[model samples]
Each structure stands twice: as C-alpha cells, then as structure tokens.
Target chain A: MKNVFIFTSMLLISLNSYAAPPTFEILIKDHLFYPDELIIPANTKVKLLVKNQDATPEEFESYELNREKVIPGNTQAIIFIGPLSPGVYPFFGEFFPKTAQGKIIAEEEGK
Target chain B: MLLNSVILVLREVLEAAMVVSLFMAFTTVSQQSRYFLLKAIFLGLVAGGFYAYFLPEISNWLEGIGQEITNTMIHLGIFLLLTGFLWLISSNIVLPNRLVKAVMMGAIILAISRESAEIMLYISGFRSDHFLMQSVLSGSLIGLGIGVSCGIFLYHLMIALKPAAATKFICVLVVIVGGSMMSQATQFLIQADWLTSTEPVWDSSHIISEHSLPGQLLYALMAYEATPTWSQIVVYLTSLALMILVIISARFLQGQPKYD
Candidate 1:
C-alpha cells in the first residue's frame, strides 16, 4: 500500500509540471500592429488579448493557425492559440494588409 | 492587381445583375424599358461617386463625436440599407412583378451616387484631378453597362418562360443576393468605425489572416470579419430584426385588399 501511494503521487506531480498556460497581448493602432512578431511555446495553450486603438476597425487573422476575428476600434479582444508545433506563423490585418502585418514564433519552451 | 480588379468588378456586376434581373422579370411592358434601366444605372454611379467623395470628409469631421459614434452610424446605415433591400426581396409584392424598373433604377443610382461608388474608387486607390466628377462618371458608366446587360438577358429569359414560374425564381434570387449584400454592408460598417464594440466575441488570431482573398471576398459579400465590436453586433442584429419585420409586414399587406 505504501509503494502504490508513492507511485500515484509521482504520476500526479509529473502531469502538473507539463501543464502551464501561456499568456500574451496584441495591440492595433492607426491601422498598424504593435509587436509585429510574437514568440510563444510550441504545443502549449496561449491566451492572447488584442486591443484596437485606431479609429477604424481591424481584423486579426492567421491562415496557418486557422483563426479570424474582428477587433473594433478602441476595444480589446481575447483569443486562444493551439497546442501547435514549433514554427513561424504569420498574421495580418485583413483590410490593410500592406501596412498591417505580424507573425507568431512558436518555439519549444525552456529549450 | 489585375485579377483583384477583375474580381471586384465582377462582384459589383453580379450585384447589378441581381437588380436588373428582378426588374426585368417583373415587367412585360415595352414602353421606355431601356430608358428606365439607363437612368437607373446613371443614378447608381452618381450615388457611388458621392459616397466615395464624402465618406473620408465625413469620417474626419466626425472625429469629435468619438470613434464609437462614427462606427455605429456607418454600420447602422449599411445595416439599414441592407435590411431595406432584404425587405424588398421577401415581400409578397413580387419583385419582378412589382416596380422592377424603378427598383433597378434606384439601386443603380445608389450604386453610382457620389456616396457609394466614389468611396469604393478612393479605397481601391483611383484618384483624379477632377476627383469627384471623374470618379462619379467612371463608376456610373461601369454600373450602367452591367445593369443594361443583365437587364437585357433577364428580360429575354422571362419572355421565354411562364410568368408565374419566372416570378417565383426571381423572388428567390433577389432574396439570396440581397441577403448577401446585407451581410457585406454590415461588415463594411464595422470596419469603417461605424459600429463600435467593447471586444471581439471570438478571437481566432492564431489561425487565419482575414485579409486574404477569401477574407476580402467574404467582407465584400457577407460582411464577415474575424473581429467584430459590440456596436457592430448591435447594428447587425437590429438591422436584421428590422429587415425581417418590414418584409413580413409588406408581405402581409400584399396579401390583403388592394384599392385598385
């Protein structure tokens, strides 16, 4: 019984060690994007907040990640990114692509 | 750039086609048919020009009202116009059978007017020394040509088919096109700061970029955007609601007594 209890405790500890969430933020202003490049851990869940400070509406989208959302002017929106593999993911503003663009760099955590 | 321009022109042409088809299907009269269509196309171009010329000025002037107001109103206007279009489509008055010529003319006028096409021209990066006049004339001519061609085709098709069946098909087509336009207009309002919201309800930022071809097409046709503000949501919902109500009432009235 003692050995079994020790084994169960070790399993629980190991699971908890690998399960931390990542947090990030983005801002949209003057039809442009701030922090045009974003880096995060691969295969880890991430919470992203996008704030639009411009007078016009902007869209935050990424074909690689398969996500799209509208960020209204003077507002903020929250989004989640996947348990994705490590790589470079690009994003941009839908209305003004030439001027508004960004990327996400997914890398292995603690590597 | 060429392909993009073609696509844009085609999309606008399709819209013009819808308007023309609805008009042609409704009328069997031959008197002044071509004249009516031409006038409609002319008016649409003028309206488009007006919008293009004045939107920026209006937007800039509205700076003091706050972005929220500007966004909401723009969105609201688009929403209202789309809803009005939808209402026209769904009502029992039978689009092709009712004032088809008049509606076509109205839509064309709206399309080419300084308010609509002009804004599109500017946004698409077309500029001239005689900015307003040139834009209006160009947009009107384009819309007119499309409207005339579509009108001619639909008129012939109706002549070949039974009136009852033709009317039904035209009604369905109008609803589809009008609904799509409403969606697109709603998106435009949101992007223009005519609809202000607190936050985007869903953020798919990690996935697709909404500015791509598919995204832009959706934006132009159905007004779908990756991010939408609170005021945009409100305008979309309210406009949809109003459209539905108006359609239902119009249909009911059509079914009731006619003075004539």
Candidate 2:
C-alpha cells in the first residue's frame, strides 16, 4: 500500500509540474494599447486580460493569433492564446484600426 | 452597460422630446392647426430615416466635392446648428410658444441629418461596427419617446409654477448642449484631416489610452484627444473660441444676460 501511494504521488507531481499555466495582461485605453508588444513561451497556454479604459467600445483582434473579442469601454475581457510557435503576432482594435493598433511577441521561454 | 446605455438614451431622448413638445405647444396656440404639427413630425422622422438610408450616396457625393469643400460644409453645418441653438436661448423664447413650426421642423431635420451622417461614416468604412448604427437608432427613438412624454408632463406642471423661468432655463440648456455638440463635430472633422494642416500638439498615449471609458466620454463630450496633432488642436481651439464668441455676441444683441 505504501509503495502504491508513493507512485501515485509522484505521478500527480509530474502532471502538475508539466501543466503549469503562463499568464499575460494587456490594457486598452484612449484608443491605444499599452505594453503593445508581449513575449511568451512556446506551446504554453497564456491567459490574457484585456482591460478597456475607453468610453467607446473596441474589439481586440489578431488575425495571426486567431483571437477576436469585443471589450466594451470600462470593462475587462480575458482570452486564451497559444501553443503558438515563436513569431511576432499583430493585433489591433478592429473598430478603430487606424488609431488603435499593437502587436504581441511570442517566444520560447527556455529550451 | 445599463448606465452607459441610459446616458446615451437620455441624450437622444432629450432632443426628441424637445422637438415633440415644441410641436405640441405650437399647435395648441398657433394659427396653424394641430394637423400641421403632426405632419411636421412625420415629415421630419421620414426625412431622417431617408437620409440615413441614403447616407452612403450622400457621403460619396460630398467626397467628390473635394476635401476642402467637405471640410467647409461640415464647418458650416456645425456653425448654423450652434447659431440656431444660441439664438433660441438668448431670445428667451419658449420653444413651443414662440418657436415657429418651421424652426422646429428645421431642428428635427438637422437632428435626422446628424444621424444620417453617422450612418454615412459607417457605410464609408470609416466606422467598422454595425452595432453602433443600431444603438444610435434605438437610442434616439427611445429618447424621443421619453422626451416627448416628459415634455408633456413638464408643460402641464409649468402651468402651475413659474412657466417663464422654466422656459428660459430650458432654452439656455438646449443652446449649451447643442453648441457643445457642434464643437465636437468641428474637432472631429479637423482631426480626420478634412481641414487645414496643423502639427500634433502632443501625445498622451504614454499616460493613458483613449480607448478607455473616461477617454471616450471626454472625446464624445468635449472632443478631448490625448494625442492631438497640431492641426487638430488648432481647429478645436479655433472652433471652440469662435463658438463662444458667437454665443456671447448673440446674447448681447438679443439683450439677454450672459450665463457666465
């Protein structure tokens, strides 16, 4: 029974270590984006929090990243991006693309 | 969402309400029968919807007029709107009792025209979302309904209170609000590069993005921009200052004391 319990514990630890999640935060304000560029680990799941500070509505979209979502003014939205390989992903305010534009930099965290 | 929606609705409703109330009041007292007032409202609404539907065509034609001409037209439209609003206030005329039906008709027409302009902007691909179009239309309709009901209630209530003061106050409020809208429209045209060349005065993206709620509200209400190009600043300031001067002159000429 003791041996079996140790094996089970080791398996659980391995799974937890392998499944750790990465996170990122983005801010939307005044028809502009902050931290306009971001980098993250390859094949890793990323939690993106987009906080919209504008009084008008805006849509956060990235064709390369395959992400599109509406972030109403004075609200926040979360999106998952990832398992993406190393590349520079461009994103923008689909509504006011001319004024609201930005990019995301995704890279391998480590070998 | 509700609060923001309500604010939007209220702004639109107030304008509609004013129009309806003016119509009702005028018809009750004017030599023209009540039928004329109803016809005027119907005509105004239909014209507004028609303008909205044809905004794409209208904008194309306007664009063909050249950038300078379009800019001039926008500026002129804003100026006339501001002037009419100011005159209404300074003259201390109760909109319903003293405003001619033709003036009310004109005001409604202008409101509809503004709505149509927005539709034009959207259809031109200047604005991406169709949702905004629906929001504007629904909000305006709702506002109109509310405003009309409120105006009727107030008109009756005023009969018991100081009607003259109420009328004067309402007129001033309308002028102030309408004049502010004109200022915003003027600034937008200038920023869109429709007007004269000017440098970017400064950029504030480093501090806060204008996509946020506060930024948008300021932009919508006052044409506030964090990163205003030089030309945009010039146009904004010039138009604002001119509007103020015009309002003052109008008040003085009409023998109405300035509010400030």
Candidate 3:
C-alpha cells in the first residue's frame, strides 16, 4: 500500500512538472513597465515573465487577474495566468503604483 | 498624500515589528536586555539588505521554481522555531536559559529579514529627484514610528497580564502568526504547481477584502484569509489545535517548583 502511494505521488508530481506554457516577457525599468501593453492568446494557460531591470524591486500585482508577486531589483519573476474568454487584464507594479502599469490583452487566436 | 504613504508602509511593517516586539517581551523582560535585542535586530537588518539584493538571483535556480522554494524554506524555518519554543516550554524541560533566548532571537531576526525586504522594495521605487521623494521619506518614517509604537504597546500589555494569561495570549498569537507562514508557504508551492489545492473554501471579501486596511492588519496579526482554499483552512485548524494543546501542557509545567 505504501509503495502504491509513493508511486502515485511521483506520477502526479511529474504530470505537473514544468511543461513550458506559452510565454511573454515584460520588463520593469525606471519603475515603469516597458511595452505597458502585452498581447496574449485567449483560452490557454500562459506564463508571464516579468524582469525588473531597475536597481529596486517591484511587486507585479493585478486585482482583476488576482495575481501578485515581488520582483527584486535586477531580478526576474514569472506569473501564470489561465485559459479564459477574451478580455483585458490590467496589472501594475505595486511598489511604484503611480508609474508602473500595464495590461494583458487576451484575444481570439489569429486576431 | 503623505498620510496615505505612511499608512501603506505602516501596514507592511506592522507584522515584522510585532514579531520582533513579541520576542522582546518573551525572551527577557529586562530593560538592559534591550541592547542585546538591538544588536540582533541590527544584524537582521543587514541580513535583510543582502536578501533583497540576492532575491532575484536566487530565484533563477531550480527550473524557475527557485523563488518559491527559497520563500517557502524561510517561512517554514520561522514556523518550526516558534513551534519548537512552545514545545520546550510545555514539556517542562528545565532547558538551558540560553536555548530559549536563542530560539526567540533567531525567530525574530528571520521574520524581520523577510518582512523588511518588501519595505525595501517599496522605498526603492521612489528614489527620484522629484519633490514626491521627500514626502515619501517623511511618510515612511511616520509609518515605521507608528508600527513600532504598536509593537511596544503589545509587549507592555503582555508583561502587565497575569503570568498564565500572558502565556496564553502570546501562545495563541504566535501560533496564529506561525500558521500564517505555513499558509503562505503553501500558497507559493501551489503557485509553482508543486502542490494541489482544492477549491476556495469561502469568499468573505465583500464583507472585508484582504486589500483593505483592517483586513491587512488582521492578515499580519493572524493569517486572516478573505478567500482561503480548503487546504489552507485545514492547515490552520490543525496547527491551531496542536498549539492549544501545547499551551495547556505548558501551563501545567508552570505549576512545578522548578519553573518558579
């Protein structure tokens, strides 16, 4: 029974292991998000790679998308967002909310 | 504008200050021991700076799971320390006094390192030459001042309570705080897809969202989740129950002449 449990756990873990989702990168410079606008495909789970190029950290946050994480100065972080109907997802750098802002435009394929 | 900034920083720093202050009273209530604490805090601050600097680089390891792993490890470390201290106190072990002090001190320092990193990140955002920078500085100072004052108040209040009562209060508070760390660690693991989480148990955000001031305060004090997943709920309840049991046992230990 214990052997079965261990095998099942390993199998489940492997299934979720690092399948590289469609990825997009957004850079943080001078406390502002570069390309302030990002476009992604709708109805598919995707990874959003945020690289903070500034000498300070910035927290990438979005209430609409319900995601938040801090990227330290000169560091990069990843956030994953889901399969959904086409829509706009707005995100901002929490540390410098006044300036660091952006949006994700998820649209139909080939649109 | 300044007031808002102050409040924001205060909300962020409050948890760290309270954890440190709790230890201040717990380890040794003597006035002179404060300098000893100051030394530990200074060391923690320096370590926090290093953490902020290297956080990004560290996150780059382990196939992008490094960030989650590092954060979860720190939180787990803190949770274990507090739990161990509680166990020692309850087990009626006339352990070396230095052991208790060391655990409390290490817990406070580690907690400060993680919490202060956020504040450092926030402050780094406003280093511009504009006038806004000046106000932010003042606001951050005020926020820090207020947060520290609250921690001091809690410490004094803890000391004023009857011995048993103080023990109960601190035990409950620390356990909740430690459980929060566990919850947060679970969250990072889930985010990294290392752990499976069931559906969110409830959504009380309409009544009081985690984004609000009071909500944030509760989050810092206790891992108050407006929308907690089933796993988080399970972990919290289990941890809380165990701590209560430990506290009861510790109370029994207190009656022995060895404790006095």
- The best candidate in terms of DockQ: 3
Worst 10 residues of 1 chain B by lDDT: B63-72
Once fitted onto the true fold, the runs of candidate 1 whose alpha carbons sit more than 4 angstroms away are A1-111, B27-32, B64-104, B114-161, B192-248, B254-260
Q: What is the lDDT of residue B77 in candidate 1?
A: 47
Instruction: Select the stronger candidate by TM-score from 1 and 2.
Output: 1
Better of 2 and 3 by DockQ: 3
List pairs with backbone clashes in candidate 3: none
> Candidate 2: where are CA atoms >4 Å away?
A1-111, B1-44, B62-75, B92-101, B116-172, B175-179, B191-193, B197-199, B202-210, B229-260
Query: What would the TM-scores of all predictions be?
Result: 0.48, 0.44, 0.81
- The 0-to-1 C-alpha lDDT of every candidate, in the order given, reads 0.54, 0.53, 0.74
Chain A TM-score, cand. 2: 0.79
Candidate 3 TM-score, true structure as reference: 0.81
How badly does each model clash, as a count of residue pairs? 63, 25, 0
lDDT of 3 by residue, A1-111 (tens): 999999999988887574557888999998888889888888777788888898766788765454667787777888777554588878887777778889998899977
Least well predicted 10-residue stretch by lDDT in candidate 2 chain B: B62-71
lDDT of 2 by residue, B44-117 (tens): 56765565454334433532223223334543564465456556555544334435445655665555444433
Q: Which consecutive 10 residues in model 3 chain B have the weakest lDDT in total?
A: B27-36
- Candidate 3: where are CA atoms >4 Å away? A1-18, A29-45, A53-56, A62-67, A81-90, A101-111, B1-5, B28-32, B93-96, B125-132, B197-199, B248-260
